[model samples]
Target: MLPDGMTRRDLGWAITGILGVFFAAMISMNVVVTALPVIVSELHGTQIQYSWVVTATLLANASSTPVWGKLADMMSKKTLFQVANVIFFLSSLTAGFAPNMETLIGARFVQGIGLGGLTALAMAILASIVSPRERGRYAGYFGACLATATALGPLVGGITVDTLGWRWCFFVGVPLSLMALVLVGFTLRVPVLEVRGRIDYLGALVLVLTSGALLIWLSFAGTPEFFDWISWESAVLLALAMVLLVFFVMIERRVSNPIIQLRMLVSRTTLLAALSSASIAVCLFGMPAFLGQYFQIGRGLSPTESGMMILPLVLGNLIGTMTTGRLITRYGRWKPYIVVGSLILTCGMFGLATVDSGTPFWFVLTVLVVVGLGFGAQMQNLMLAVQNTVQVTRVGQASALIAFFRVFGGASGTAILGSVMAMQVVGVSVAEVNGTAPSATYADASGTMFLVAACLTLPAVVLNLLIKEVPLRTTI
Candidate 1:
């Protein structure tokens, strides 16, 4: 049931407000994409450092997502969303004024924590107000927010870098966040369920450390300055990550209210959704992180041109999402969309695997459109499928868990693929002899990165085929 006394119009306004916050959070993530090469070169950062800049945020966001979801179940989601917005606002300001890459990375990490809260809270809020059957239509809007923000982020980042400066990329979100804060405060009205639970502090801490260790291992290992992949340091870090993961699993099993409920994942649909989400994330998160470098460093395009180049991808995503969403709601059959979407995504990835600096732009752009269309059809729909299987009261946790895996997968993909790219870069192995530089090396190396990413999506295609789609529930 919708919240008592909440009309459809009220819900629309509330959803609008929620999408605004979601847009701001997502836009902040991508705004630096087009400007990253410039930012890193000016700051004198290495390729590893460049990867860390993006990985840090994804890691922080992934780690904190479960905690935020658990908190929403026990408190007021509207209030939590507002608080996260404020945190994002402050972090963006700090990032804008940062004097060095290290400081900017630190700020982005904190911003990701806030982003975790916003992402989880927005989905929870939607679940609370909309039935799973009806949510299919709204899911399109969520996808639009994601795609639109992604689309605008690069264009805006490009324009900001070309005209005002790259610093303005960080400042751009400030006003949007402030506006979302005000809109949400006035329009959002949802029932806060009275639930009793303790926050899983130890579980959350260990999960963070575990992911951190694994990412750190991926980021620096194999570089000559750091320990090689076969070295003792790699062994130690890998071992530490495994041990902490075991501890985290143990804590979840024993906690009164686990950050991520182990039992919920036992369901076939939920499990498949988690796997599919992670697999899709490999391409969704990993590709764009390097696309900027591919165009600017490899093809020698300006930030603005690179930004404009991606418009087709975003456009395809926008249409696919909005169209698939309405079809799922109208027909009440979601499996076919995902099944077909995954195949298309897989095909698109392979197509991209062949691209290099010298590849024709028309062919690359066509493949991107295909990839976006496939991804859009599955991304939010996977969560919708999972939410259908869970109880209304557990929606917050269920949604958060899927998101956690997606973000974690994205983080892992960024680090692992980044390491793959770094290894391929011409001077990385000989950086001591010749200083690191961003050059045509990225152009030559990008194909291997996309090939690796393409291999990762194969599992997603298989997993989506395995998912048994239960009918979406009509009640919240």
Candidate 2:
């Protein structure tokens, strides 16, 4: 080991490598949201399938996150980190060369598995090295990377799809991932434990089945031929999901080394923070997937112009995230920001609900900026709160659990919103063709989808009110 205490140079290299990996993974996910429409049209996919491209990744990531976290507790984190990178590298290449939508979706699933490992392991490693008090300062820096990636991913992806091709979006992650691999190899080292236990394969299986069934049900709900609640198929799927979830919970209680620890979920701090994290994701991840389409299809703007339109939202997110980080460090409290962020989000979403084809561009931008700010302020605050409450030994479980719920919420939200948009499009299209009035199918879908998105943010505000602010400790 270099020394008992960390040097500034050592910390700098660790933070750089960690943030670089985070930036690359986040960019890879968000970049595709703006490019989805173009990819779907080019590949001749239906709206449901297009939505699955996003949902599949989120589901895969959410499902695998806790497993990675548990593995971090038992294995060498550095070695595991390299394993994730290699998977990401290979998946990117396969995604770039995919001949059809099916193959692309499969590749994206593998990529999500890699992403889940990277995010969970990174946060666990950071927590291991940093104290709770100093973590806020570093959390700010990490938040900045997340905000930058979220903001830039769309603008860059949109431009690339329009100018280069959609395939470049996948290929682009390779070099960034490679750079991260090299940095980690040279700069970071953590002590490895050789402890071993049986992996909770049964619990993992049940959790996957539960999440997958619920997501599939949501995606098909409101589609043309999908089952209604009263229908036999829908009832069976819903019952199966309930059964699997209950079984998973029972398994967790009995297992010595559960994939997800039951004790973590029982903590009030973890429960509230987790629910809040999931709520924020529903709005943050769901809204952007369709907003780019709004600018292009509804307003008739070029892809580049559409990307440019959302820049205010990105800027607002950066400002809000940085501001919250500083305030938390100074006050050592988190509840007020969560409350304020939620209220702001509610106001912004309500404002956005009124958007239509005739709405001014400036008005839309202003509404979205408010939503972005609220999301930025609240999102990572929840994570910080949960991490601080848990012991160092359990930090990996706590961090990964928060991430799991957020991505699970994201996957479900995207599928639900996409289905809603599809139904509206089909309904409007058939009506227009049969009646005297004529309108483009794309325009109707874009306008209606945003209105629905705005409605979804309201529930998040209610959930935010339920989060209790626990005082932060000055020491670990």
- lDDT for model 2, please: 0.79
Worst 10 residues of 2 by lDDT: 429-438
- Which stretches of model 2 miss by more than 4 angstroms? 1-6, 193-195, 427-444
The local distance difference test score of each candidate is 0.86, 0.79
- lDDT string for model 1 (1-476, tens) is 67887877777777887888789888888888888877887777788878888899999999999888888888898898899899989999999998998999999999999999999889988998889999999999999989998899888888999999989999988877888887788777878985887889999999899989998998888876577999999999999999999999999999898999899889999999998898889766667768877877777788888888877778878888899999999989999899999999889989988888679999999999998998999999999999899886888888899999999888888998888888888374212212233355677788888898888888888899999979888888
**Residue range 1-476, candidate 2, lDDT tens digits:** 23234566876786788788788888888788678777777776777887888888888889989888887777777788789878888987898788889998999999999988988888887777777766777788878888888788888888998889989888777888888888888777665654578988888878888999999888887688575545777788899999999999999999988999988888887887787777678666777767776676666676667777877777778888899988888878778887898888778877877777677888989988998888888888888889999877777788889989989988888888888877877644322232132234555566667666666666666666776777787765
Using all chains and alpha carbons, the TM-scores for the candidates as numbered come to 0.96, 0.94
As for candidate 2, its clashing pairs are none
lDDT of 2 at 230: 58
The superposed Cα distance between candidate 1 and the true structure at residue 462, in angstroms, equals 0.6
Worst 10 residues of 1 by lDDT: 429-438
